[model samples]
Target: MKSTINTSQLITLPDGRSLEYIEYGDCSGTPVLYNHGMPGSAFEAQVLNDVFKDNGLRVICPNRPGIGRSSSLSEYSLSQITQDCFFLLESLAFNKVTVIGWSSGGVPSLWQAKHSHTQISQVILLSSYSHFAELDQAPSHFAGQASVLKQVTTRFPALGLLACKMAGYLLKYMPSLYFKLLMQHCHTPDSDIIEAHPHYRDMLIEAQKQSISQSASTLFMDLLIQFREWPFYLKSIECPVTVFQGDRDPFVPERIGQHLADCLPNAQYHLLPGQGHMYWFEKSFQYRLARLCQI
Candidate 1:
């Protein structure tokens, strides 16, 4: 398939589920697969796509199951999302991939190392927690923490849409106001030069998993089953693993990331001071990515 700037390509999972993926740059070049954080859409890949376009690498970012256009299954788990990624790559004729997973996407990246290490040259996990205890260190701002509040309105599966509809309105409207006030909390803002775009957040709400209630419940379930101790089953992986963390990441703390890097058999960890969990859009992040991938 030819690469397009912002175009999305559809790929089907073995279960006949259609997943949404975006590709950028030359298809024949070294393929770098991107996995985004939870409740995030592939739109988040846009910045990185533009930055790495001429770097002789093909970038691919896919929407996870139950997010965006991807089909959701009742039996979905973090491990299964990893397997789904494996088949998606195979279906797309991706023989080998250098994976860069962010935040929640790190779970599937570990899954890749565990089950498909032979097909991956290098693995990168960014701003992700390797253990359940790490959750305690997450800043109060992570929306996943608010997922429980969203789920309370949808206790009954049948009336899920109503709850979702209500939650969506609040999330869509509140974030804008919050960002305005909280911009100073993290970094100094240059409103004149940079107009912040919450495009991915908009796309997330417009997804087929449109119901905030359902998505929250599904994530709640994933956290319940996964998000702890790197699953230990990831022992088979021998590839060089790189864990990226930000000094002030609201979701990932330094100690937790250090623990994860120490646990990996062959791993290198990089700490980006003054950067937060969403490092993809930062200029400093681009340089770090270049250095990490040796582009």
Candidate 2:
């Protein structure tokens, strides 16, 4: 179970399902469980690969159900995902960890702080949301191919699955154009960053392809649940929490991050002005993330 930089493995859970994960950083360093965003897979955790190693941190990036190599679940709540995380850590002999959630991943990250705080030292949310209702404020901002998929999946389950299947087909056969439209719709800052760093865009496409190929149901279910009311409230969580968001991130507005921070009794909010949703791709941001976890 020793960690190795950029190594991938699969652990079988008690329910006969497998959890796939990729590890980076020092094998014996403080364990940091990273939760990736929507339509993203474990590979997204490698954004700060070198920073984690330099900071003496062990980062574990696991694929949620129906994503990557992980098995799918027909119906599961956000809390159930938290339980999956606990089992994954226990199997690896990790009693406690620092949980870091990015974007949609933040839902379970908050849940961990509330339901599994006993085994969580700290919680961090990057461009994340505290509730689904927050998205109502900027519906136009989320209008895109992504929004179409969500709407289809939520309103017509059968059609949603078909849409995911077709999308997956396109991603596999026509990846370049698929990513082209994706980046074309991105905010100026986000698109600029991705253009400057081709690898980031490539990573995104690869991860997304893997996600849809595995089982689009998981992605659809995630989006559907995200549109409804979350089970827990931010004010109820007592663990130390930190929220980082880009001031110009329309999908997860700066105000939403600030609002979540305000509701949490022990939380701090850091807004990166002018930056878009993918500010975490910056080295400086990665360094700050490492420092925050270590502290």
Candidate 3:
């Protein structure tokens, strides 16, 4: 809740959008740029930032274009987000950096691998799919589950909005509930991570509420756009890539992660046991990242 970390001012994007990010650890350290998942804030990887901080590795997490104190892009696409992040990297003068993308955030990372592979030293994707259509495999389908988001507005619009607003309030106070819900929805076991960090639950919830205002349809569309002929991009990427997928992931079937690993020429694939999308932000993620980065 209270942060002693002093974050610099927001960085403006080429599209006139502003992104808020936190920078910490030694500036001379190797830069590790982190992108958060959909409906998540810059704080989504707060736990990972903490984990990687002391190792002389610089960590950067922007507000992901819209969530916390960041400005929204009038027209958004994963390519544009990746370009913006590339500019940010240029501004920082980090000639090369490692990229870590988690879940929906992996879209932009994938874009980078396809379009800006030269700038990347390595890419680490967690619980990421090769294409967007994989959303059908995702465990939590707000569309199929309840359509509570769409139906509530018609049935009890006022109460629905109020509940969303309240949910936002509760988020700031109860981050743990958020993480638990995410862990549950991920439909994968994370007992090792769970036993270690109980407080992450509240942090995760805060992240969800922070970006909850975004339309669900638009979020779904993001994956749709990414899915259509997505494999082509994988074939084009020449950089070193690594993927960590949760075998039990209800959202992305293990088949996809397997197919991707087999497709990429320089990819190292790992099917993390009893994990899911949340693996990216968990402490366990470090082992994978460090191994891939050769740190």
Which candidate gets the maximum lDDT versus the true structure?
Answer: 2
Per-residue accuracy of model 3 over 152-231 as CA lDDT, tens digit each: 54456566556555655555566566455546655536545555777766566656665754543333334344544444
Kindly indicate the candidate among 1 and 2 with the higher TM-score.
Answer: 2
lDDT of each: 0.63, 0.79, 0.63
Error of 1 at 281 (Å): 1.2
Q: For candidate 2, lDDT tens digit of each residue in 7-112? A: 7799988888888999888778889999888878889877877888888899989888888888888685776677889898888888778899988888878877
Report how far off residue 28 is in candidate 2 (Å): 1.6
Q: What ranking of all candidate models by lDDT puts the best one first?
A: 2, 3, 1
Candidate 3 has what TM-score?
0.75
TM-scores of the candidates are: 0.75, 0.89, 0.75
TM-score of 1: 0.75
Where does the lowest 10-residue lDDT sum fall in candidate 1? 185-194
